[model samples]
Target: MGRMVPAKAAFAGLCSSLVGIGLARFAYTPLIPVLIGAAWFSPGQAAYLGAANLAGYLAGALLTQRIAARVPVRPVLRGMMLLVGVAFLACAIRLPFAWFFAWRFAAGFAGGVIMILAAPAVLASTPAALRGRVGGFIFTGVGLGVAASGTLVPLLLEAGIAATWCVLGALSLVLTALCWRSWPDAGVAPATRRAPPARSSLAARAVVLEYGLNAVGVVPHMVFLVDFVARGLGRGIEAGAGFWVLYGFAAIAGPMATGWVGDRAGFGTALRLGFVVQAAAVILPILTTGTLPLAVSCIVMGAFTPGIVPLVLGRLHEFAAGDPAQQRALWGAATASFALFQAAVAYGLSFLFAQTGGAYAPLFAVAAAALALALAVDVVARAIGARQVRTRRSVAA
Candidate 1:
């Protein structure tokens, strides 16, 4: 245990996640107007690309289970980074819509692998005493990535979208190389992970349901939040950039806050609170789009949403008995759920906005509804699990 804090694991995990998340997911929001203006994509195309990216992420998540089981996590993470670089470079070509979609999918797949892999690996490697702090710091890399992209993409948008993609790809590759070099090879444990729930259907359905509800709540923020500000709120690039910076910082803080809370209290409490925070965060900014309220919402969303899902992931370990491969699969599936929900929201709202002629408030209200539903589902699941634990205790007694 003392030897396990390999600098490589921490740096590689953080670097891989930053590039994967930044280049793949967070970049889309800022790139929206630029792509729309350049005539490279339509609203439909944008939504599809997001779905496709998540599909790719799902694939990567699946692939990671295999890769992590056979090979060391360090190399797998590095390879994903390089793959992301390729996908990023390919996006520079003013290819047909199909080609761009395919490239985006590949980026999503690679990025997903990095995100899914880095998250668990970071958490698993840390000593029990320091897990919360390290996890907080590792998760913050996502904010770092989001902040960088938000700030830099506008400058790139001033250039051509193609140039922007190329530079982003180049930057990711550089980071990947640096982190790969920094990473030390951690030992692999080849033993089969714990058997997943024997009641397969029940577990599967619960996970899917849990993930789906959470996804619906998040998509509005992830896909349309920035665009809402730019288009509906009438706040342009600076507002968009500033909003995301606030979000990124908040994301970095969220895991740390929750991690501490989890350490002090219980994981369930942290997760429930996180979902509540997410609902408020999305709703508050839409209700009041000024600097102050938006800033608060940004912090709220950033600190809460991104980290809560991982808390669910941790909970899965308790039920699944810490089976690494199965845990990875669950996370990959969750990411897909996240994307699909976002797509549904975007597509659904695109039509609604077209019809109703309302502001972002209505759409945000929809997101809030979704989060509320997710919280309900989570509360039910937590209650059931608690009951089961009590039953087993009673039987043993």
Candidate 2:
């Protein structure tokens, strides 16, 4: 579209994601192996800790939405960003499991608030036509954060986990400060005060289903990829870190490419392509242990996992049109649904992983199947959209 979204505003949105999602959420993936190696927790306990974050995220999504109904979003967003940094600092205290869980949970909660608000804020500032590209650029912060974690965390691991936690927290505050002034002060529009429709249409329902399925499909990699690569593949921690870095790089690329495709072809088309590739990528490590396949798998998985979110959110944004209130509600519901599925899978798969004697193949199989199902649902949604367009044209004629 016209010049894409503004560079300064888009970069601020990216930094919000960097602190909220990249540092708060995805940073845990590479840290999973370290937590195991340090004996702060066993694999199963560590999984629970991770699950706790998702649980908090789900709760935060619901709570944030409820609060937004009554209060302004910008203040909440700023408060959440501060909380994210504080949560990270609290994690460095090295308390009991319950305490650690609470801190992580709080971080996830803050992260949830940031995720729900940041996209809407950024999209609201930009032209409707440029939302897709702006969304892509915003998510690149996640990839950058992931890449930073992959690269920086390992180096920081040399300093010990406590130190690492403090450092990460400090970095989060710095990023938060940088983006502090960027959020819009305009409160929720008066029109947004009226509640959204009681029932969603079939297309909206299908979109929610697709979003949930994608969440399930991502679990194997998010929680277990480094573990699978290091322990399962017998590659050791460094190789796993290398794969993580590859994934981070790919994550950055995937969203940008998807944005370009969405701008030209359509968001639906970009999503379909991403799902197919991601499904294969999820299953690739199990298919062959060769270096090339594994690397390709890591890169593809990295790119599409976060890449899908912008596409999904873009479509949902379109559904809400100019209604800020509806957009907030939609984002909250979509994110909560995604977080619920992810939390369920995290807990369930941990138990399964323990029962299966740590074999990762089955998890990959499940992830691939979820992605396949998501693709199928997306296809149906696209068909319905096309049919609706045709009907409208006919009526107009």
Best by lDDT: 2
lDDT by residue (1-397, candidate 1, tens digit) is 1365666666666777778876677776677667887788987787688778777876776666666667677677777889888988988988789998888888888876776677666656555555555555566667676676677887887888888999889988888887766654333343256435533334444655666677667666665666677776788856776676777767766766766776556555666776687888878865666778877776777666556654655544444445555655666566666656655666787777778775567777887888888778777766786788899999999
List lDDT for all candidates, in order. 0.69, 0.80
Q: How much is the lDDT of residue 157 in candidate 2?
A: 80
Clashing pairs in 2: none
| Model 1 weakest 10-residue run by lDDT | 186-195
> What would the TM-score be for candidate 1 when compared with the true structure?
0.84
Candidate 2 ranges with C-alpha deviation above 4 Å:
1-4, 32-45, 185-192, 198-200, 384-397
lDDT of 2 by residue, 227-255 (tens): 88889988897888778788888888776
lDDT of 1 at 364: 77
Which stretch of 10 consecutive residues in model 2 shows the poorest summed lDDT?
A: 186-195
